[model samples]
Target: MAEPKNEEFLDDIEDAEAQAYAEEMEEIDDEALELDQLRAERDQLRDRFMRALADAENARKRSDRDRREAENYGGSKLSRDMLPVYDNMKRAIETITDEQKEANSALIEGIELTMRELLSVFKKHGIEIIAPEVGDRFDPQHHQAMFEAPVPGTKAGDIIQVAAEGFMLHDRLLRPAQVGVSSTPAS
Candidate 1:
């Protein structure tokens, strides 16, 4: 009976040790799972942060391009509106007769001064005049042909008449010069 009791006690201790080892292994597995979850969360957050940073940089570049375009072309409409005033003044100057100029010398001088001031302002604002002569070759990019006529002693595509002068605003054509082209046949 004493020997049987000793064997039972040893069996109970072995069972307890096996149970403790199983619990320790379970705890280690739980810790490993928790660490894996933390790593996955950190990777997701890093990816999102990198994408947001790229989007912000693209927006800044787009806005800078818009600002530059606005600065360069802000006064385009106002400059275009001022063209007819220049044409009318030029016509007035052209129609003045010699007798009229002699009689109204002071008035003519005032008009001339005003015209000069207007041209000076145009030059300051990057406006240029496209003055094509009657005998020069016609250019379709700068001249708009109003009519085609076979004028004597003129070659084909020659500029016969210039009805209205052209204007340019900083390398862009505001108005093309209205002209008449010669359609002469070759001799």
Candidate 2:
């Protein structure tokens, strides 16, 4: 009977040890779950940081491009305004009477040379004249129609007259060419 009692006590001790081991394992599992949650959060933060850095870089690039464009086109308006002066000087030379020019050949030559030099300065600064020649096809991108006229032999949509010469600075249009375009003949 005593031996039977001892055996039962030993069985009880073995059951208690197994329960303790199971509880320890459960605690370890809980710790592992918490660690996994922390790692997931860290990964999300890292991903967000990288995305923000990329967005900032893109914004910086856009700002740089915009600044360069602004700087390049800054003088366009003033340059356009100055074009009329150049045109007036040219007209003064061209419209002078033949008698006046013949009487003052040296003075006329000096004025002509000055006009050429002024044009050279314009070219140096990337300013260009938009004087389309006669019989040239009218381009709406550069020409502004002031009137429509029918000529004896000229085709429709052709530039018959330039009211005011246009100009461009770099690739930007400073002014559209004021032009008289030919009209379609009356049927």
lDDT of each: 0.90, 0.88
Predicted candidate 1 versus true structure: per-residue lDDT over 49-142, tens digit per residue: 9999999999999999889756655666887798889899999999999999999999999999999999999888788999999999999999
Candidate 2 per-residue C-alpha lDDT over 47-156 given as tens digits, one digit per residue, 9 for 90 to 100: 99999999999999999999977776777877877888888997898798999899999999999999999889888878888998777889998989999999867889
* Model 2, TM vs. native: 0.77
Q: Give the best candidate by lDDT.
A: 1
- Candidate 1 residues lying further than 4 Å off, grouped into runs, are 1-54
Residue 153 lDDT, candidate 2, scale 0-100 = 76
